[model samples]
Target: MIKPYFLTALSGLFLTQACIADVNLESVTLDNNPRVLKSIALLQSLKSPQTAMQFNAPYVHDLKNRYKVRSLFVESQNLPIVDIQLTFNAGSARDEEVATGLHGIANMAAQLMDEGTEKYTANEIARAFERVGAQLSVKAYRDMFIVKLRVLSHPKKLEPALGMLMEILNHATFKKSSINLILSNTQVGQKQIQENPSRMMNVQFYRALYGKHPYAEPISGTQRSISKITPLQLKQFSNQFLVAQNMNIAITGQLSAKEALKLSERIAGNLKQGEKAQALPEPIDKSSFDIRHIASDSSQAHVMMGHLGTSRFDSDRLALEIANQMFGGSGFNSILMQELRVKRGYTYGAYSTFSFSQVPGTFSFSYSTRQDQLLSSVQVAHQALIDFVTQPIDLNQLAETKAGMLRAFPNNYSSNANINAQLGAMGFYHQAADYLSQYPKLLEKINAQDVQNAIQKHLHPERLTLIVVNDQLDKTALETRLKQDLNPQAAQPLPTENLPNILNPPEKEVIDLPVSFPTDAPEAI
Candidate 1:
């Protein structure tokens, strides 16, 4: 009853429908089969072979002016970016003992670099860089002040940026208005820091640890000191510390050795050839263990405990670093974290660190817990440290710790900025140029016995100073706990007023008075 063409079309439609039904059934079977899905996941879980990191040392050049420049030329033909950092061995540590406020002056001077120059206004200077997508930043650390610039490598962008930077370095005006603004901001910041319990704890801890050492002084000068700083003092500080002899230049990214050399010369040539800063004196260790309690109206108590630690030049630094990682520096796997957070639920986190400086630095273990648990938490953390140093770590723990450090080492140089920072540190600390390349090897050479020896020799948990900042601490309970868990003789109560008042000045009221002018008729008559 149907025509031939219609029959052909009907047959083709039926075949197509059958093929689609088969496909749908196949898909359903694949999705429903657990073994097949597991097999697919297993197939996708392949990983590439792990490779060891190889560090390339930078080309070191000495400029005619006695400035040392370290250049690392990363070849990136596809990209056009360059990073330059000029580090001067002029930080808070160099602030004269007689002129303690010079620390704030140095920091403020670094900040004022881009505020304005003889040739460019502040706004204009900012626009010059913003238009070309460049960035300029200044940082003042405990040991150094750094001026950094990042810009495109093209001549148009690079030349102008360099010129602007030179202008800032050689001809910065440090206007009175800018100085006043910086001083006001610094005062406000210090006041805010005073209100922060954790910061106050650190300030107190450092004061206890360093004693009369300059390290005890806050990096940002105290309110009283900052208020006394003048624009002339800032200029004098710049002249003394920011000199050719005291500077190191680090250049990275898309630049040749010759170009970097020329740039470094240009940057350092205009700088004054002043003498290097005087060296810092060694920090003296406290005679006995001490505990200081600061009263605060906070629900959580902040505790910091430890003492003076080794310097960058310590022979056992690598071993101590690994030992610290196992004891508390590592996250959840660390002994302190496990004891305080997981096993006892005493705190949310606990950590220990060794801060290595040019001179001797500090080792600190810190934690925060509910006010009620303050003493108990301190006892637990203190015991953990004592046990870590007294007991020798087994081979497995040592292996795991070393492995973790090695795994994280490559991340130290993961970015241009990080690499530059490391380089700057090496220069500032006078570390060998090959220090980065040799670090992993040194870490590998450390053994279980080495770690144990370093801990036993350097870490003195019995001498740690415990500082607690809490409003709710029960003095009777704290005294009882100390007698039970620690030496009763070491426990001492400190008045909150005795705490460092670097930020806040004694409260004073403003009094308004009528002023008499020379031209006032009544006063003249």
Candidate 2:
């Protein structure tokens, strides 16, 4: 006998073929067409079996390096290309070490690294890479600075690309002209952030949550901070953080383990053996609800609520990952989406996410709605979080989430590039070498009770920090409404003294300092 799912699939395929054969969909009017509408309805009704997919684990090789540079390699002979990434602990978080107020020094240094080295002009550098069909890119995040190179596996192509990368790392000159260009672009971005509601809310949110910590500042830095960055500071930052001891290497594609080790050593030998960056201080957790209201002219309200969450090293990290997926991380199946978008039609989308980084990261839920519906949406989202934290997990949904994750797990390392990325992250975070192989078994062992316990231990609904960008009311009125709606059963009303004074933000104060310029400045445009 033909099974139900097979019959449904066969029917769907024949119907699809008939529609394609009979109709010119572009020419047909869709408004009142009976046959087309009937076909669409029939297609929507078709279902497929949710069977688990098995995938073989990719073999990962750990290459030994004597230069203190950790290395992970995976050999893929199918492609005639190589990908290399060097991840350093020199992100914006280390800016303060360069100077007290140099928030963007790391970002500035990264931008200037490849512009001009001691041996080549910026244009020469560009043409050299182009001649070899190679690509070099640099990016700085809150936790790490990454330099990536991609080139064909042929010796001629790989040799020149590797040489250019080393020259940039060891002898790049951070000229004054490049500094001025980045500063000008950052100033424009700061102005644009002020005018954008979502960006403004993000800036204020971090400030409120991490008062005096290093993470309080944005990676881009503020106008006041960026203006103070100098060429000397950029050089100091680069020298201190970009070192063999402070970074790791990830190599993938068309390379034997022996060759990969030699390549890793050559790359590591070019840099100074500088000390590792000191560990970052953890951001303090809030005790009470801290709310801020940014008055905007937008008819829709942008809201974000969260607090400091767990770190990458936490034992319950995997459980919290699953819990977050069930709560708001998944699109339509998430609890927040079902309550806010599907049931009430309050917003088009609602999402919750967790960031597990070097220190405790943030767990946040964000959504936007009409100004008049702001309070209702906030209440619904908050209540959903409360119930999720305080109640038992739904066992059926937990099973479904685990199954979906298992099926999708193979996609994480499906290609050489993707596998290299995973290896890089694993080495940086000090995970066991068998982490990838063990992830599925560990995840399967996480029961519903474990998920519920993890949620209860990590998530704090009562101590959330809230930020809203809306034009509906003044700060005082909005504060009152939030207190009433969120804590209706409190014998005494929720306190507003802890709220930030958002109405009168201080103006940027500037101080002038003498600056020096390189004698061989690039010619002005």
Candidate 3:
């Protein structure tokens, strides 16, 4: 490392330069001429933000069934490496209420596909990917199970990689030993995640708000479901729910349109087609109008509060998109972050987001503050939501939000992974395949009045189901505060069952208890 003196001297030089460049009153007065003002404006115009442009390359979607096969393909070969992705909608949503995390189960099940297949062992698959610098990844999200394979420039190598990946995606033994070990490891992970109050708060919050909307389930899934996810059940779920209609495949990077179409045919074709999927039920259990406080042993509180909002298909989706950015989704400029973190120093950082599912999604505000500041921060966030819905969004602020949304799209879809993710999202929501293409225009159409209208139509802060995970908080005081801010009738004490038994023991049984192992340690008996 450079010596401290050298670093200090370099800093001093920069500081001196900054000081010399500082403005004086006389300099400001002298520079306030019409020509100077005009020049400043001209420079500002020259430095204008680049408008986010659309990919002019026409998106080609062609599904083929050649030689007794069926597969869907969208060909856009922009790079040398051709990507093949196969997806199925056999996510956790397909799990029973008891099997809450089936989506996670499906995902974990897929990972074992390459562990050892009927024809190939784990070592062989690893060596293949290693030899060719290819990669295969499997993941289960809220709505789908995804299998992605990437291979080199050679079509011959790419075809073999795709074949190997397809075998994994389509037929996995999900060996019993692997399943048991995965479940055991998952329990360990579950304990760690639940230990974090934020994760705990979000999980319980979703369950409370959505009640039974598949949206209520955890993304990865729960331990109970994972444990009971027998290999046979895995096969059934894959066969039933993971069908063609529920699947979407997206390709980007390295390949020609004709080759892409051919590749898609070779991979997904002849995978028995299923019926068109219908829309999922909305989180319309709007009756869950409650405020829940989950006490944990922590210094700062983890808070997440919001209610059901719009779906991707809603006309005001674009408006809500802009609304979310203005609220807390846009980093520093948002009111929640500005007030809760920047102004009050209550949190390190704060942000609010409204997640849209196929159905009415949740509009949530989440943040953490010191134990003492918990209730106060929650109240401020609540009030901000209320204000956002009731008041008219300012035109300048509205423009900024829309501009940010518009400007961020290209970056969002910059990678093949990103493009596929967005496509998957849009496809899951039954959105127009052209939604991305029409995004800039759709967002441009949103006006100031539309934002305010959307807020009123979708946001119901008063009806929010608040979740605050704070340790040793004054429960009575919080209830009182909530009553004063929201409706008096809505205020209710902590429900006995709302608290998840994450710690696996009652507070009374463990608190301040002395450790007494038998004087001589207990025997194996």
Best by lDDT: 2
**Model 1 misplaced regions, further than 4 Å:** 1-78, 101-103, 472-525
Best by TM-score: 2
Q: How do the predictions measure up, each by TM-score?
A: 0.80, 0.83, 0.78
How many backbone collisions does model 3 have?
9
> In candidate 2, what residue range of length 10 has the lowest lDDT sum?
516-525
Which of 2 and 3 is ahead in lDDT?
Answer: 2
lDDT of 2 by residue, 208-274 (tens): 8878887778877877888888877877887899999999898998989999999999999988889
lDDT of 3 by residue, 1-525 (tens): 899999999999999899757834234332456444434444444445574344542353434435322332344456667566666665555565225445466556665667866677788878878777799887665555677777776867776677677666566677788888888888888999778676677778778877767767676677876767777777666666655666766666666666666665655554546554455665664643477778787756677777776765688877887888898878889887766655655565677766554566667777766666677777667766766777667788888888777766676566665665555555444456566667778789888888888888888865778777766666577656655556535643321222222234333321211111111001100
* lDDT (tens digit, per residue) of candidate 1 on 378-439: 76777677678777796787899888777777776666666666666666666765676777
TM-score of 2: 0.83
Assess candidate 3 and give its lDDT: 0.64
Q: For each predicted model, how many residue pairs clash, with residues at least 3 apart or on different chains?
A: 0, 0, 9
TM-score of 1: 0.80
Q: Judged by TM-score relative to the true structure, which candidate is superior, 1 or 3?
A: 1
Q: Which pairs of residues collide in model 3?
A: 69-270, 70-269, 70-270, 71-268, 71-269, 79-254, 80-254, 92-103, 101-221
Q: Considering summed lDDT, which 10 consecutive residues are worst modelled in model 1?
A: 516-525
